[model samples]
Target: MQPYFMPYLGYFQLARSCDQFVFLDDVNFIRRGFINRNRILLDGKPFAFSLPVIRASQNRPINRHSFAGAMELFLEQLRHTYRRAPFYGPVFRLVESLCLEPDMNVARKAAASVAAVFAYLGLPLNYSFASSHPAEGLGGECRILDICRRFDATAYHNAPGGRHLYDVAAFRAAGVCLRFVKGSFPAYGQPGAETFVPGLSIIDVLMNNAPERVSRMLDDYVLEHA
Candidate 1:
C-alpha cells in the first residue's frame, strides 16, 4: 500500500493483519487519493484535510513529493477543531510533533504519522517502504510479486478494494498465498455528532477514543483467501 496521510482506521487494520507490511512508495502517485490527504471531523461532519504537496503529480512517485504548506496553521486548525475532543491533549501533541517535524518529504512524513500512532499505542511497527529495495520498472501485481520475493514472504495481504486486480493462480505459481483483508471502522463517539462518521483519519480516532481503545479496534478485520 502507498503511504497515506494519517489514514482511516482500516488502514491500520490492514497493517495489523499482516506479519510484514510494505508501502508501495516507488509507484506513481495518485491525485485525489489518500497519499497526502485524509478526512477529519469538523463542524459535526467529515472535513477533508490535505498536506499541500510541492508539484504533486500522478506521474511521479509518492516519495518524490514534498510538503508545501504552513505547518503552524495546520497545527492550529487541528488544535481548534478538536479542542473539545476527550483525548485531544495527547492526540494533538502527537499530531503536532508529526506536522512540526523538519522532514517535509510527503511519504516519510505520512509514514511517520502511522509509525507514531503505533508507537503511541505501544504497538510494533513492522513495516517498510518498497523503495528501500528497488524493484524498478515493475508495476501492478508484478511489482508486488517482486516485493514478496524480496522479502521471501509466503503470503500477500491486500485491502479488499483491490481484490479484483490480483490473480490468485499467479501468486500460487510463485509459491505465495494471496488474500484480501476486509476491515470496517468500528464506530466510536465523535463529539457533537449523532450519526457517526466512519473512515475519518486516525487522528480523529485518537482524539475521540483512548489509545488502549484504538489499539483494540485495530483487530476489527477479517482475511479472505483469494
Candidate 2:
C-alpha cells in the first residue's frame, strides 16, 4: 500500500492484521487517491483534508514527491475541526507530533502518520517501504507477486478493494495464498452527529473515541480467502 494521510480505520486494521507491511512508496503516485489525502469529519460532516505535494505525478514515485507548503494551516484545521471531541487533547497531540516532523517528503509524512497511530494503539506490526528493496516486475500483479516472493511470504493480504485484481491461481502457483480484508467501520459516537459517517480518517476515530476502544474496533473485520 502507498502511504496514506491518516488513513481510514480499515487501513489500520490491515496493518494490525499483518506481521509486517511493505508500503509501496516506490510505485507510481496515483492522482485522486489516498496517497496524500483522506476524509475527516469537520462541522459534523465528511470533509477531505489533503497534504499538498510538490510536482506530484503518475510518472514519478510517491517517495519522490515532497510536501508543498507550511503545515500551519493543516494543523489549525485539525485543531479547529476536532477541538471539542472527547479525546481532543491526545488526538491533537498525536496529529501534531506526526504531521510536524521535519521530513517533508509526502511518503515519509504519510508513513509517519501510520506509525504514530500504530504506536498510539500499541500495535506490534512492523513496516518498511517498497523502494528500499526493489522487486523484479514491471506491472501491477506481477509486481505484487514478485514482492511476495522477495519476502518469502506464505500468504498475501490486501485490502478488499483489490478483490478483482488479485488472482487466486497466480498466488497459489507461487506457493503463497491470497486473502482480502473487509472492514466496516465499527459504530462509534461522533461529537455532533445524529448518524455516524463511515470510513473517515484514523484522525476521526482517535478524536471521537479512546485508544482502547479503537484498538478493539480494529478487530471488527473479516478476512476472506482468495
Candidate 3:
C-alpha cells in the first residue's frame, strides 16, 4: 500500500474500506512498477508521466531508488506539466512547498506530498510507512497478519493482486479474515471521451474536476468481492 504515483481511485476505495493502511515503502521497487510513474489522458491520448530516480548498484534493491541531484528539476517538470490543469495552482503550490523544503528527507517529502493530495481530496484514512515499524522477519500472510494484530484489525483487506500471493485459510486460522477488493469503474469528468476509461491515475480526475467533485466521484466507486 505504498503511496504510488497518484494511484487510481481503487486505491483510495480500498483504503476507505480498511481501518488502517500501511505504506509498504521498505519493499524493493520493481523497475517497471507504478512506484514512480502512471498513465493519464492528455489531448485525447494516453500518456505516461514518470519521475526519475537515481540508478542503484547491482546489489541494491529496486525499492532503493533514491532521489538524486535531479530532484529540483523533477519538481519543476511536474509544475510545468500540471500548471495549466484545473486545480493545478493550489496542488502545484502544495507539492512545491514540500519538494523545496530545506533539508527534508526524500521519503518524507514524497509521503507528505501524497498526504497533501489525499487531504485535498478529503480522504480520512490514517497512514504509516513500513520503514517506521520495528524490524521483523515477516512476509506474505504473516506480515499482513502482524499488522492486523498490532491494530486489532479483525479483517485484512488487500488489492485484488494479492490473491495469488496470500493464503486466505492461513489468515483465518490466525484469527484474521482476508478480503480482496474488487474494483469497478467510477465516472469522472474527462474531456472528449465517448466511454469512461477506468484506472487512469488519480491525477486525471484531479486535473479534470474540482476537489469537491473528485470526492463525490470517489464516493461513487463500488467494491465487490472475488
- Order the candidate numbers by TM-score, best to worst: 1, 2, 3
TM per candidate: 0.96, 0.96, 0.81
* Candidate 3, 1-226: lDDT as tens digits: 7657567777766776776778776665666667666777655566676666677433443345565534576566555556677777776666566556663333555556567677887778688877666447886567767777877877777888777877768777888777877666557656655567768877667776788877766565444442
Candidate 1 is scored at a TM of 0.96
Worst lDDT 10-window in candidate 1? 69-78
Which candidate comes out best when scored by lDDT? 1
List the candidates ranked by lDDT, beginning with the highest. Answer: 1, 2, 3
In model 2, which range of ten residues has the least summed lDDT? 130-139
Clashes (N, CA, C under 3 Å) per candidate: 0, 0, 3
Candidate 2, which segments miss by more than 4 Å at Cα?
none
Which residue runs does candidate 1 get wrong by more than 4 Å? Answer: none
Candidate 3 matches the true fold with a TM-score of: 0.81
The sequence of per-residue lDDT tens digits that candidate 2 reaches over residues 1-226 is 8899789999988887787798998888898899888888777788888778888799998889998856788889888778888999988988887767778888888888898887888877589888877865566888888878878899888998888997788889999889888886877888767588998888888998888999888887788998
Top model number, TM-score: 1
Tell how far residue 221 is off in model 3, in angstroms: 3.9
C-alpha lDDT values of all predictions? 0.87, 0.85, 0.66
Span of ten consecutive residues with least summed lDDT in model 3: 56-65
Which candidate, 2 or 3, has the higher TM-score?
2
